[model samples]
Target: MPTDQIDIERYHQLALQKQKEHRLFLATLKRKAPKNLDKIVQEVHTEVFSEIDCTKCANCCRTLGPLFTEADITRIAKHFRMKLPVFEEAFLKTDEDGDKIFQSMPCPFLGEDNLCSIYDVRPKACREFPHTDRKKIYQINNLTLKNTLFCPAAYLFVEKLRERV
Candidate 1:
């Protein structure tokens, strides 16, 4: 879908309105999801993402901070030719969960064109963002619910999965 076709404000409002319903649905799904649930979700994820250009809707990069593992920190720091401590001091902060995350919204690596400057070396969490296509779809229902608020592709994946299963 075109970026213009995606009304992000409308999605946010709709997601809020349906939050309870979606939560209950996910809880129920977690308890009794279909055996093919992962396959179905993967199909939906592929279909939704194929149509939606993420570069046009970098809301994830703009609004969400991905957790950076030690390996991720090391790799990214190496990419910048900076020491780990310097990189951490410059761009990272410890979140409530003790996970290291970017210090601010709109990730520093995000370019003006809405692409990741370090796409190849981006953190594992970032690389697995929205995570709609992961195996055992029911295991990450909570994450998926949160993602719907930020990722149009994730929202569409859930909607499509509802229709499918």
Candidate 2:
């Protein structure tokens, strides 16, 4: 990988590729979710994190637009004391067909070091990011494909999890 040209745009592309691999792995998990997602998530995270440095690959926060729910939108809007419509117009957009997503990939709120500008009040999806680390994540099996390739942490996490079962 070329590290020199990693502006937001390049990071965005790298994020897409990571998401792709995650999706591929998720398909295999559909057949079985190993019985213990928490421990599995932890073990895999241990392995994955050893290989990841969010500072270096902020691709997840930078590229993926979280699928914030109605409640999520309201909470975020209230956090900023901005009306929902205003917040939506300024930062969010309905993804291609309809689902709500951020207007830009490599979120505008990303800082010089790729930190989230709204960390404390980030959307629900943002808080549980890489949902692979979430407890009983198997409950979200319905959403695996979309989320699988959505972040590098998720991609590597899923790979390690799959290896266990």
Candidate 3:
């Protein structure tokens, strides 16, 4: 791994240590996020990402599955030149919550080097994973909090936010 790359093991360990603080921080964020929170977060997102490369650490793709929407199914199916049902049968299964997800972890579309096989037509959820730079930064505090456990960028974003806010 690169020196600047986040080690998933260390990230999780630190995340556990900071869990309570993170929860309290998020609660405080929900109560009153600064007006420029989104812009500041976007800047942090960009800065942190400069040193963090997703290709080196696809923990999100290797761990949590993306929610596949109907459009995602259609687009991916079309990209594969297969019938939708055929694609679904081959690559998808509904989770306990009835949400369509990839049938396996280390997502089938993930290449050996962590590149996405179907990058262009990947699900909307995949496109938005981590979501640190999204608008209305305060609105997604809960989701952001959850992501910190699995996404290094989110972890870094929240850590950086702590200093700025």
| Clash count for each candidate, listed in order shown | 1, 2, 0
In order, the Cα lDDT scores of the candidates are: 0.87, 0.69, 0.88
- Clash list (residue pairs), candidate 2: 19-149, 62-106
* TM-score of every prediction relative to native: 0.93, 0.67, 0.94
Measured with C-alpha atoms, the lDDT of residue 113 in candidate 1 is 82
Q: After superposition, how far is residue 96 of candidate 1 from its true place, in Å?
A: 2.7
lDDT of 3 by residue, 8-108 (tens): 98887777788789889978887988988788888998988996899878999999999999999999999989999999999999999999998989899
Number of the top-ranking candidate, with lDDT as the measure: 3
User: Which regions of candidate 1 are displaced past 4 Å?
Assistant: 1-5
Error of 1 at 93 (Å): 1.4
**Which is better, 2 or 3, measured by lDDT?**
3
lDDT against true structure, model 1: 0.87
- lDDT, candidate 1, residue 5? 48
lDDT score, candidate 1, position 25: 83
